[model samples]
Target: MGEQPILEMKNVHSGYGSIKALKGVSMKVMPGEIVAMIGANGAGKSTTLMTICGIIKATAGEVWYDGKKINKLNPEKLPTMGLCQVPEGRRIFPRLTVEENLILGAFHRKDKEQIKKDIQYSYDLFPRLGERRRQEGGTLSGGEQQMLAIARALMTKPKVLLLDEPSLGLAPIIIQQIFDIIKDVNKKDGTTILVVEQNANLALQAATRGYVMETGEITLEDKASALLENPKIREAYLGE
Candidate 1:
């Protein structure tokens, strides 16, 4: 008898052929929430995002987005539905110019003028990106590439943005800059986020709610602040 969730997974089971990466995983993200799913390597965090986006099919259960079941929807149609994912490794087109990469994110939209405005919006979000808008994506530093990847996703004006390993391989200061932008994006754009990160410390610090996954199953979940103080979480994830 409360507001329905914006994105949810109900007893979802998925994997690569026989791998069984997720075992009845269940989670929900409310409107305007920053929900962090944290876990170690091979914990199936990335798999969860991929499955929700339809790149990895859910063998069982449901993935509900906005208000409908999307487990079976065509993967290419997800962006139009406002569920956008920025996957691991900052997968931007190497030969494409920074501006060109950003435009591709809005490939589904016909609002050419608004897309142009959003391109400016992204530059404002990451000024470094604006400086290199004409440069090839691969020529940018790792941090800049990450910025372009996020900027590209924002072009869709997604309702729920799924981020996987945004901090991976970046320097600490750059990681800080990226996370700061993530919070700003959540507040300024009012976009809900579900981030999966191996850096549990930073993820918990940024999220309002947190979920801990181990061996493909979620083992702990609570308010972000509460989880930060949790002894189990401190020892396991926070490296106490």
Candidate 2:
């Protein structure tokens, strides 16, 4: 068999109350690979990421990380296991300074020295954050806030990073910058990433493989290059 995947969801069924958002969805991300989940609104892309991060509990099926089932783990427990998520809409603390917000990302850890090192690492990763370290999170531009959010997530030292809609509402140039940083993080830190995005073109360009979800089901799975050339994807998502 091929090398075991770093993260796997097998026939996952989850939703709010009785509304099923994910129906038997199964996907995997191998170590050091950037995997993209692309779909339109209400396609269950965000739900998949939330379920994986334990923000939304899976009512059925299994989620496995490092060969162990984690469907029932609480969200607070996930960070300790090296699973972190930078949720949709940069959820930084508007009232807190940039430095403080980043520190909160490591709340579960007790190693102050290591946390300080990680903080410096985040600054190295996003120099803009370092420049505005004392500024309130709400004062930063959208792109800057997004960078802080990503940097904060990294403070947890995650092995599997789930990024939800990282380019939600940003300029094309800023979006390009974010994608570049994501690839850099993957390449340099060996962080396995599972990204949910509506920007199919950019997402496919950055990822090694991708899955297309429609109405809570994965309708297509292929190498990023293959999906980029797909006629249906071009017509529907690529706006060709």
How well is each residue in 30-145 modelled by candidate 1, as lDDT tens digits?
Answer: 99999999998999999999999989999999999989999999999989989999999999999999999999999999999999999999999999999999999999999999
TM-score of each: 0.98, 0.96
Top candidate (TM-score):
1
lDDT of each structure? 0.94, 0.93
Q: Which ten residues in a row have the lowest lDDT in candidate 2?
A: 1-10
At residue 210, give the lDDT of candidate 2: 99
Q: Indicate which candidate wins on lDDT.
A: 1
Q: How accurate is candidate 1 locally (lDDT)?
A: 0.94
The backbone clash count of each candidate, in order, is 0, 0
Kindly report which residue stretches of model 1 are placed more than 4 angstroms away from their true locations once superposed: none
Worst lDDT run of 10 residues, candidate 1, spans 1-10
